[model samples]
Each structure stands twice: as C-alpha cells, then as structure tokens.
Target: MASDMPNWFAILQAQSYSAGGTVPLQCETSATYIAKVIRKVQNQGYAFISPSHEATADFNDVVSRFFDDKVLSESCNSWVKMGPGRSRNLVWWPGTAHRMEISRDPRWEDFVFGRAKETRVNRVAYFGNGWTERERVGGVESITNYLKEAGKGDLATLHEAWNE
Candidate 1:
C-alpha cells in the first residue's frame, strides 16, 4: 500500500483552510516526499527517478525566495503560521515549542539542499533534520490524538483551544 503521509497531509491542510490558517506543519517535515525520493534515487540507483531540470531549478528558486522573505520569518527551524487565533510562532517540536528565525542561515541551504557524503548524487536536494524513528512515529501519534480530541472538544465549546 502507498504511504498514508499524503492523506494525512491533505487532512491537515484541509483543516487549516477551514480554520482560516496555514497548515500546522514545518515545510521540511511535511514535504519529505521529495527528500525521500531524492535519497532513494541517489542511494538505490533509481535512475528512472528524475525531476525535470526546470522543475529542480524552480524549486531552488522558491527556496531562495522563502528565505529572503522577512515577513514570513522562515529558517531551517521555524514554525509556519498555525491555526487561526493561535500564535503564529507556535509549533510542535516534540511538544509545544517556538524557534527563532535566523535570517539567511547557511545551514538552511544544507538542511534543504545538501546530501550526505555517501549519496551518489553530485547535486543538492532536500535534506531535513535527522529524526529518530521513535520521535517521528511518536510525534505523529501525539498529533493525531491531539487533533481527534481537540476537534471534538473545540466544536463542543465553539472555541479553538487545540493549541492551548
């Protein structure tokens, strides 16, 4: 079966839209599909996997612009806009947390575009943080539980208190 990540992402995005907020996910965390594929193409000799040259270039450009946008306050470790009526700076990094945006941090390039030395690829691609299996799995379960309960509780109370 195909991975459920995409469906999970769609559900989260839909919730954000309904609540008048941006998706409550870090860009790198949620967009790991490309990163995983890139890693596979490099490590597994998946020559059939190819992103058009133009598409790759455009993605790099977009990353550059995201870092350049001061208003958005993006960085290698930054929270995106969360649910409506919630602090835009709030995020879940193992738990409720906040990060300071480091303007044009060089690590952002490495985090987003660098490959490990062992990889076959001689080019930059998506590289997110190193997450242990327990952290990744537990985090997802935690969020799912929170969403299920909060969705029920918030609707009952007619207020959004999920982030509280």
Candidate 2:
C-alpha cells in the first residue's frame, strides 16, 4: 500500500478518461494524486513516488525538464509555503492551487545538443479552497437543497442529468 500511489494514479487516470470530465473520486480528492505529485517533483527535482506503469514516463519527463531548466530549479523553493523568501514573480502556497510549465523538449535538438529555454512559473488561482470538512462531505446534498430553496430546481435538474 505504501508504494501504490502511482498505481492508484494510473487507475485514476484511466477511470477519469473513461468516465469523461468528472474525476473518479471516493474519499480523498483528485488533487492528492495529480497536483501534489507534480508539485513534489517540481520542488524536489524527481517524483516522490514514481508510477509503476508506463504513465510514470509522462510525469518523469516533465519534472526532468524542470531539473534541467535553470530558472525552475533555482526558484523551486519559493513556490511552497515555508517562508516569504521565495521568487518575487512566482508563488504557489501550500493547500492552495498552483501550476507550472516546463518548455524544454527532450525529443528535440535543443534538449540534448542545443541551448534550453528558461522555465516560466505559472500560478493558477482557485476558489473555495478553504472549505470545512463538514461542508465538503455534504456538498451535493447541500447544493441541491440550496438550489431548491432558491427556486433553482431547473439548474439542479440539469446538473443531475449531466452527471447521469
């Protein structure tokens, strides 16, 4: 079980792909798998836990480019919430949303024989990140109730139909 994150990730990816836009979630959120792992590799220069499947290659490829890119490796520490000394132009605090992109192409000439481009920090903004646990568990029921109370039954009906 300790070494199963990647495998779980592979299964989750497959499930998500099969199930369409909605993530295949149970108790924990999908962020625990995708976002956390990507953030970890971006900061540490390697995957915290590599997936045993071929999917590992995709995740590794992106992080490896980060290690090779000077800008990212040098500024990786500031993205986390440990302190205020992080890079001035970029930041991704803990328990909140964040994103980054590596522009290096491993299959191209510059990746191996030519000069590599600098990495750019991307910080994405997400809403409702600090909701309480009780609020989360009752999300669907509460939202449905709220919609009904607010005379938005049509929207709730549309949502239920879309989910089906």
Candidate 3:
C-alpha cells in the first residue's frame, strides 16, 4: 500500500487529518461532501475567469494560487460555454407569444411543433396555446399528431386533451 502508491495518494496520506469519527473520512457521506467542496471551488475559479465587473481581479488572484494554469484555463472555457447570453429575449421568445399568435398565424403551430420535435434529444418541447378548454384540446391534439409523426411511440399519450 505504501511503495506502489501514486504520488498524490502518498501526499494525501501524509497530509491526512482525522475527523474524529469511528469510520474513515472515505465514507459515502464524506465523499459526497468532498465532491461538493471541489465543485464549489471549481465554480469559484470560474466566477473569476473574465472580470466583467469590479472586485473580479482580486477574486481571480485568490483562486489562481490553488488551481494550476491548465485547470484554470479549462475552468475559464467551461464558464464561457455555460454562461448566459448577453441578450435574453433574442435567444428564446416567451411561450405566451406562441399562444397569442397560434390562432392568427397558420404556420405558428408548424414552427412550434417542428422545433419541439427537433429538441426531443434534449427533452425540450413547447406546449403553447393551452389557455382555455377548446384551445387546450386543440394544443393537445396538435402535439399528439406531431409526436406520432415523429415516431415517439413510447411517450405517454394524452387522452383527455382539455383537462390537463
């Protein structure tokens, strides 16, 4: 266990501290806590990546000492990929707009249904125009037809269209 151990493992053992518990710190609960701590540290590192506002430079310096250059670079890239866009409404129009225009525009349902089908892999679908009994029924029927045509057989079929 000593001679064949990896450098990090040896370092961990040398620097290991007791938690005053009967069981070791490698227990499931302890492991989960450690994982949460690591994630928090990573998020903190990401928060300092591109200083949009004041105080970011100070925070970046604090996180840079613990995380290596490669790790920091990767963290910065991940943050950029996951961060919200500068424009909010430009990316995704609200569902209310779909409902309002569904009756007036013949192509509204087609556009909404098509996009929903496309997002099946990501498990995202738009279910607009379900305001009233008649509208809700129409919405359900349209979605059902769209799903059936898309070959989504395993999806739970909605029978009472208006109620839900």
Candidate 4:
C-alpha cells in the first residue's frame, strides 16, 4: 500500500509490517522499530526470513514507472530464488545448545533472502511439508510451544506490528 520504494521503511512495511506510519513518518517510525528488533531474533535461537510481497510488487511497479529493465537488471543484484521446489519452507542455521542461529552478517541476509548456497546445504537444515517431516515434527505448533517454554512467547512483540 505504500508508494515508497527501496527505503528501509518501505522494505519493512512492504513485508506486511502494520506499524504506525504514514509516508512522512515511515522513516523515523521504521528506524525506531528496527533498533528494537535487530538481533532480537538471535535471542530466540533463530532468524525469521519471510517474503516482502508488497515491497517486491511495489519495486517492480516503480521500475516500470520510472525506469526500464536494462537499468534495473544492471543496477540491481541478482535476486535470491525462493520456493517450495527449490528450497524448503524454512532455512535454519544451528545455534548454541544445538539450536537455530541468527546472524547479523551479510551472509545471513543472503540466506534470509534465500540465495543459492549449495555448499551450506549439508551444514544447514531445511524443513519441508513431507509426510515423513510431519511425522517427525509437529511443524509450527511445536515451535510455538517451544517458544512458550523458552519464555519467548510474548505476544506483544508479534502484535506490535499492527498500529492500533
């Protein structure tokens, strides 16, 4: 729903963050938000990487409105390929105590973006929706339960995205 593109706020809001922000307020609002949340996921023993569908669509629209594909293809870096067939529902890196790891490094961003990293395939874990996987694990429900046990189940953080 935002017309802004590529800016940090645009990126966040585009990714379905429903915080208190309008066009002018988005920058400051988003900055404050990022400050609070950065590296917070590491405390939970994992990092979250979800699609910014709105942002992506807005970016393409901007490109068409202001420029052309040649400029875009040349200036923009290659996008990470993410999907069910190529990758899994989740990409996980191990953390201390044999849990998931969340890093703030560029490589971590690449992984979050779902960029190809064949070498890490053996080192990292990918969970899909296979029957065997379901039998072995309880999917998101299990993870939510684990978070509650770990004292990381504060619903406020999740709900804070929506601007009341």
Please give, for residues 1-35, the per-residue lDDT of candidate 3 as tens digits: 02222111121221122223223432433344334
* Model 1 lDDT tens row, 50-74: 3344544564454445334444344
List model 2 lDDT by residue over 96-142, tens digit each. Answer: 12221221111222111111122122221112255644458867665
Q: Count the backbone clashes (under 3 Å) in each candidate.
A: 0, 0, 0, 1
Q: After superposition, how far is residue 31 of candidate 2 from its true place, in Å?
A: 7.3
Q: Write down the lDDT of every candidate, Cα atoms only.
A: 0.36, 0.34, 0.30, 0.34
Displacement of the residue 20 alpha carbon in candidate 3, Å: 3.7
What's the distance in Å from true for residue 73, model 4? 21
Provide the clash count, candidate 1.
0
Ranking by TM-score: 2, 4, 1, 3
Q: Residue 47 error for model 2, in Å? A: 24
Residue 161 error for model 1, in Å?
32
Q: Candidates' TM-scores?
A: 0.20, 0.24, 0.16, 0.21
Model 3: lowest-lDDT 10 consecutive positions? 6-15
Q: Cα deviation of 113 in candidate 3 (Å)?
A: 45
Better model by TM-score: candidate 1 vs candidate 2: 2
Model 2 lDDT, full chain set: 0.34
| Ranked candidates, highest lDDT first | 1, 2, 4, 3
Model 4: which residue pairs collide?
95-99
